[model samples]
Target: MKILIIEDEIQLVQSISEYLQTENYTCEYALTYRQAVHKVLKHNYDCILLDLMLPGGDGMQILEEMKRLKKMDGVIIISARGAFEDKISGLQIGADDYLSKPFHLPELAARIYSVVRRRNFGNSNIIDENELQINLLAKTATINNVELSLTKKEFDLLLYFISNRNCVISKNALAEHLSGDIAGMLDNYDYIYAHIKNLKKKLNDAGCRNYLKTIYGSGYKWEI
Candidate 1:
């Protein structure tokens, strides 16, 4: 999934981004409220990790703006202020979850998964689609009770397609989802083809139907 981290602490931001990246999540960072707002306006994010205190403006104001735009993006508030009132206000303002500072990275990761699950996958850890079963927490996929070995990229691609089933996903969109903002720097999306091809092949080899389709000049679709 693609995540936006609106944190002012450079070390914390880098650590969180690196940790999430290791788990196959594409991350973008914004150190100030202005930069955060610019990113929210420019790109689509699966979830946003927002810090309450920020330079230039408060993160609550950013949340208000997002709600005004009807963005429907999931948000998790992370702040040093651990007061009950702060948590209450965040939830009242539509924050999906809250995490106090000095929290464990793994705990933060789990919270992000929970928020995304609630927002996109019906709040379930196990996503089942007929013969295909995916354990989001374990990051494993099984076809007809048989585990299919997949590279991290292949697994992420499959999950992305499944979550957005029936929607036509353009190559550029897929590239951006997989690589985040840096996708724009690439010359071509040849890597996307490679990942999709490998994922499809692996699934088919494991007795899964060809649910992934290529649309000539358009892109791909996951027709489950």
Candidate 2:
């Protein structure tokens, strides 16, 4: 999943990014209100770690912008301000969860997983898509009662594709989702192609239909 971290503290941002990356999450950053607003407007993320205080503007304004635009991206306010009023206001403005500054990285990861899971799976840890079943917590996939030995990246790619099934997904979006920090510097998408090929082969070997379709001169679509 993709995450946006909106915080001005360089050290905190780096730490969060590194920790989340280890949890198999792709992260992007916005150190200022303007940058945060711009990224929120231009791209879609599974979750956003928002800091209430920002350089250019108050982070509450970002919440308002999201509300105005009717964006459904899950947001978790991670601010140093632990006031009761701040928590209430953030939830009232549509944040999914609130975490104070002095929190553990594992807890923060857990919250992010909860938010993304609720947003995408609607209270279920297991995703059932046709004959394909995925246990989100275990990060395992099975098709037609046969298990596939998929790499972590392959499993994640499969889940992402299935979640967004029948929708056209660009190579750039996949690259960014799969490769967090290195995405911005990517000059080619060969790695994506390799992963897709391997995933398709594995699925096909398991007697699953090839539902992933390539759009010539465009990107890919999970036709299922």
Q: How well does candidate 2 match the true structure in TM-score terms?
A: 0.57
Give all candidates' CA lDDT scores. 0.85, 0.86
Model 2 ranges off by over 4 Å = 127-224
Alpha carbon lDDT at 132, candidate 2:
81
The residue-by-residue lDDT of candidate 1 on 1-224, one tens digit each, is: 99999999999999889878866789999999899999998888999999989999999999989888988889999999877898998999899999888665655775786678877876367988889999887889999999999999898888777755665667887877678667879999998999999999999999998889998998887886
Every model's TM-score: 0.58, 0.57
Our tally of clashes for model 2 stands at: 0
RMSD of each: 12.5, 11.9
Candidate 2, which ten residues in sequence have the lowest lDDT sum? 102-111
Model 2 over residues 1-224: C-alpha lDDT tens digits? Answer: 99999999999999889878866789999999989999999999999999999999999899989999999999999989988899999999999999887665655775787689889987468877788888887788899877889999999788767655565667877886688548779899899999999999998898888798989867887786
Cα lDDT of model 1 overall?
Answer: 0.85
